[model samples]
Each structure stands twice: as structure tokens, then as C-alpha cells.
Target: MPANIKALKARIRSVDSTMHITKAMELVASSKIKKATARMEESRFYRRVMEEAFADLAKTDSPYSKTTDSDAPRLYIAIAGDRGLAGGYNNNVFKQVKAAYREGDMVLPIGRRAVEYFRHHGAVLYSEDYTSSEKLTSADCAAIGRSVTSAFDEGTIGAVYLVYTEFVNMLTQEARTKQLLPLVPDEGEGEETHTAGTVYEPDAETVLNALIPEYVGGITYCLAAMSFASELAARRQAMDTATKNASDMIDDLNLRYNRARQGAITQEITEIVAGASE
Candidate 1:
């Protein structure tokens, strides 16, 4: 074997090693995507139930809509990813959050990326660096729910709103803001108005208290599902890109190896012919 061919074999070995690593990463990401997708599906059901509960309570003329003080501060719960490479998934939420903020509003950033983004802009009232995993359980949503509600009760925040990506479909997701406190009645809906005025079972305020927390829970659950799904989709895409890049590099390296082998083979043949003639 010529020295040139030997070197080419070594280069091929290095490329093979790289391919193995990328393939392993792809498999790992695929498994995570499966688990994350299941969690997103389960959370969807919880979200739907919560929405239905809120809709029912609204029919009772819940006082939750009318009980709000004028002099209160607004809170923003901005959820972003800790790491990026998933395209605009995290940036979309950040953009929406920046667009939604008004003067004198406070922010509660979730995820390390969100905290870093908002740190220089304004006051960060609260932040969670890394909570929630590939699969978001009810407990995860509830924990976050408790923190925001606690802030509201302490008068540290008045209206709490969440800004994050909403997974619409496999290929389409969008950034959205949802009100998490002072639960509002679903817009364009009202108590069934008839010639006879509507009546409440006990009272409007009574029903509102019972319904408000459920509304918050629903929003939290939905946000978790959407965020998790977005993460998986992003990661899958990132891994796919990396695999393609590795393949391209291997192609280039193989081309170099082939040319080097040809050159060495020609040199050896020429040397043998010259020796025979001498």
C-alpha cells in the first residue's frame, strides 16, 4: 500500500467517527421528540377541559371579570428556551414580549434565554432559569402557577400575562400573549341574553372566585404543551442540519482522498518503467 493511500484511509476513519457521533445524536433527539410529543398531547386535553370550565362559569355572569383595581402593576411572564439553534422559536416570543410591553410594566422571565434577553431592558421581578422538562407534567404547570398567583396576592403584580409560542400545527407555531390573572371572560361571549334578563344561581361574585383559578390553570397547562412541542421540533431540525453538514464534509474529504491516490499510483508506475529501461 502506498503512503498516500494509507493517509487517505486515516482520513476516512476520522470521518466515520464523526458520522457515528452525529447518528447517535440524531437517535437521541428522536427519542426525546417522541416523549415530548406525548406530553404535549396530554396537556392539550387538560387545556381543553380548563377552557370548557371557564366558558361555563362565564354563563353565570361571574364577577371575576368586574373585580379589578385601577391602581395595579402589570406583570409579564416571558417564556423562552435556555439554548437555541431551533431557528426563531425563542426569538419569536422575545419579539412579542418586547412589542407588548408598555411603560412601567414589570417582567417575570422564564428560562435562561429569556432572563438574559430582558436583563438589560428593564426590571426583572422574577425568573426561573430551568424548570419544566421534555415532558411537562401537571405538577410542573401547577408549580409555575403557584409562583405567579403568589406574586399577585402579595400586591407585587396586578395583571399577569404570559408571552410564549403557541403550537398551531407541526409546521406552524406562533408567539402569543395570554392573560393569566384577573381572568377575563372569553371575548365575543356573554350570558345568553333573551327578552328575560339572565339570572345567577347564587351570585356573580361567588361564581367568579371559583372559576378564575381554573382559567389560570388552563392557560398554564396550554403554555407548557406549546413550549415543549416547540422545543422538540426545533431540536429535530437542528440535528437534521448537523447531519447534512457532516455528510457534506465527508464527500469533500473523499474527493481529496481519491485524487491523492491517483497521483501516487501514477508516480509508482513511472518509477518502475524507468528502472527497467536503465
Candidate 2:
């Protein structure tokens, strides 16, 4: 075969191999998405319940009920993915972190990428133990919640914010942040709305204090589940695009190779006829 044709053949083979890998990755991501979505939806419900409970507590006269701005630095919880090649999935979260970050503010990075990014930039780390966002369990969230709540209660941090990617649908994911501390009570809601049909065990204040950590933990776990699903969806999309591009390249290469071979064959026939006539 001609050198040009040989090179084209090599390129086709390479692209075909790449396509296989990307196609496999796409299938893997797709297979996991359904379960991830289900988990995300379940956690969302739990998070909502916890949030409403906190909002009800906010209506009370306790110190934790009111939102306050202290001189202390804010704590930012940044959640990213452990792996890359997900087409900006991790970068979006990190961008949100940089946009919201301030001097002396502490960061709790919940994935390998987030940890590496912050450490490279010399940001203050709250904890480096949580290295995998997807692997984090409810227990892990509880520990994180307790630690964070303690810091807030002790006035070490003035506020708390969670930065993550929200999965809106299979094709849509959004990078957003939500404030988690200093519970904001619903405006115009009367105290009777929460206190009317409920009874506290020890007292409302005590119950509120205990519930705060659970609320935070539950919210964190649910958001993490959502983010995990988002990450998988992003990976699936990226791989699918890659697979299609590879297929296109392979087709183009095959066309070129066929044309080259046909030209070579026509030249050979012409030489054979000229020799016979001579």
C-alpha cells in the first residue's frame, strides 16, 4: 500500500479504538444514571423536610434561630468530582468556589479535585479527610455536619455556604450555591403556624440545637447525591459526543483510503496497457 494510504489506515484504526473506549464509558455512565437519579430524588425529599424543620425553628426566639453576621470568616463547602474528563463538571463547581471565596474564609473540599485545586492555590482547608464525594455516606455527612455546626455555634465561622452542581435533568446541570447557616424564617409566618400542634420534649431551644446538626447533615448528603448524579450525567454526555466524533473521523478516513487505492489501481492498468502496445 502507498504511504499515504497506509497513514490513513492507521488513523482510522486509532480512531476506531478511541471510539470503542468512549462508547464503553458512555454505556457505563448511562447504566449508573438511573440508580443515581433515584438516590438523588430520595435524598431531596429528606433535605426538604430538614429544611422546613429548620425554618420552623427560625421562628422561635432562640439565638440560633436568627441569622447574624459576625466578624468571623465564612465557611464554604465546595463539592467537586474525584475524576476528570466530565466536560466541565468539576470546573463549574470550582469556579463557583473562587467566585464566592474571600480572604481568611475556610473551605471544606469534598472531592479529590477540589482538594488539589484549593491546596495548589493555598486556600485554608477546614478538613482534607473527605477525598471522595461519591463515596461519602450518611455517617460521613453527620460528622461533617457536627464539625461545621460546632464551628458556627462557637462563633469560629460567621456563616456557611454550600457550592455544588444541581441536576435539573439528564441534559441540564447547574452550578449553584445555597446558604446553610443562620436559618431564615419565612416572612409573615405567624409563630402559631409552627407552634400550634407541636410539642417539644425537653424544650424548643434544646430540640432546635440538636436538630441543627441533623438538618445540616441531611442537606449535605442529599446535595452530594444530586451532585454525584450530575457528574455521571455529564460524563455520559461527554463520552457520547466523543464517540460520535470518532465515528465521523473514521468514516472520513475510509473515504480517503478508498480514493487512494482506486487511483493506484487505475495507474497500474494504464502502465500495463502502454507496455502491451509498446
Candidate 3:
């Protein structure tokens, strides 16, 4: 009985230690969420503005409105979290990208996990410079934007897609994909929507071409921000659950230890009485 009680005590201490670590992780995640959400909101607004500007090109029948060639390879910008223990946050991103992957598609991964996963699985990479999503800045995204646009212009890649986790709510984070190139215009759109006095300085095509790189970079940054926020939220939830489970385990172990100790004491008292009677 004493040995069993000793084992239970050790188990409780181990669980208690784990509980503290998980609680700490949960607190850290909660603290960073405010900043992450702020970045997401700002980037979302910029992305919407750029999307509206791109719509004007569709009305003008810019060459970019045409569909990409069927033979050319596709490129995917996959954004994932740098660390794990965030539930299925990382796996969902890989799944979303692979669902649309083709035989000759190339990937430009923006997170450490993403870079490691794609490279380990033999997927072709465009570049490995942008490796850590946690350290990513707008400038890095802009550079990615320039590279992808240059590839589009050179006829190297057929299409561009961004795979990211969307922050729907505190309880819901969903993996999603967005097409980045060959802007698909709504069929319902008409040229009459163009403002009456608006004029392109050089030409609409020249203006759009100049804006494409910025558009790609801005959207990438915002989407990455959303993904990062989603990751943090998921991690916080996971750690909370872990901490709760650990607490429950500790409680159960302590109960068992108390019962064992009582049994040992009762046995000792009976033995002493038996010796006195003998």
C-alpha cells in the first residue's frame, strides 16, 4: 500500500508540472492575439481596396483577364504556423494545398513547418528564403510578390494560389485557398460602372501592371496575418484543454493516494491490536 501511494504521489507531481507549462502557454497565446488580430484587420482593408482597383481592369479587357495556358505549371503560396501543438492548424494548411496540387505544381512555403513538409515530401520549391512565418515582415511578402509576378510575366507559371487559415471566430479557424493571378472578373460586371471622369495617366494596362506586385504583396501579408492569428487562437484552446485534463488527472491521483494511505494506517492499527492480544 505504501509503495502504491508513493507511485501515485510521483504521478501527481508530474501531472502538476505539466499543468503549469500548459497554463503558461495558454496565457502567452492569449496575450499575443490582440496584436495579431489588429494586423489582420489592417491587411484585410488594404486587400479589399486593391481588389476593387483590379476589378476596373476586367471592364477594360486587360490581357491579364485571359485564362492561363493549360500546359503551364501552377504555383502555390502555402502559409502555415511555425510551431506545433496548435491542434490541426498545420495539417489543415497542407491538406488545403495538396487538394489542389497538380503533378507539375511548385510551392513557395511561408512557414517553417510548410517549408519542411513540402521539401521532405519532394515537392518542388520556388525559393527557400522565406522560411519562418513568425519572423515574416511586409518586405518579405513584397519580395515574394515581385518573384511571383515576374514568373507570371515570364510565362513560367500558369496560375498562383494562396493557401491560408481564415480566422472566422474565436472558436472557428478554417483553411482556405484564394486565386492570386489571372484575376477572374464577374460576368455580371459591365463597363458602365467605370467612373465618368477617371482617366489612366499612361494607360490602364500600364497602371494595372504596376499595381499587380503591390496587390500580391499586400494580400499575402494580410492573409499571413490572418493565419497567424488563427494559429494562436488554436494553440490557446489546445493548451487550455490540456491544462484542464492535467488538473483532473492530478485530482484523481490524489484521491487514490489518500485511500491507499488510509488502508495502510488501518492495517497497522489492526496488526498492533493483534500483537497486544497475543
Off by over 4 Å in 3: 186-199
Q: What is the lDDT of residue 135 in candidate 3?
A: 82
Error of 3 at 141 (Å): 0.7
What lDDT score goes with residue 121 in model 3?
90
User: Clashes in model 3: which pairs?
Assistant: none
The C-alpha TM-scores of every prediction are: 0.70, 0.90, 0.91
lDDT (C-alpha) at residue 255 in model 2: 94
Count residue pairs with overlapping backbones in model 1: 0
Q: What is the lDDT of candidate 1?
A: 0.68
For residues 9-128, what per-residue lDDT tens digits would candidate 2 score against the true structure? 889889999999999999999999999999998877677666766777777886676667567898999999998878999999989989988999999999899899999999999999
lDDT of 2 at 250: 89
> lDDT tens string, model 1, 1-278?
77777877787788778777767766766777676677778777667656555544545544434446756678887777766666688788888877877767788776667777788666655665333333345665666666666766677677888887877765667888987666655555554423124355685456546545555655776786678677667666666777787788878878988888888889899999999999
Report, for every candidate in turn, its global Cα lDDT versus the true structure.
Answer: 0.68, 0.88, 0.87
Q: Candidate 3 overall Cα lDDT vs. reference?
A: 0.87
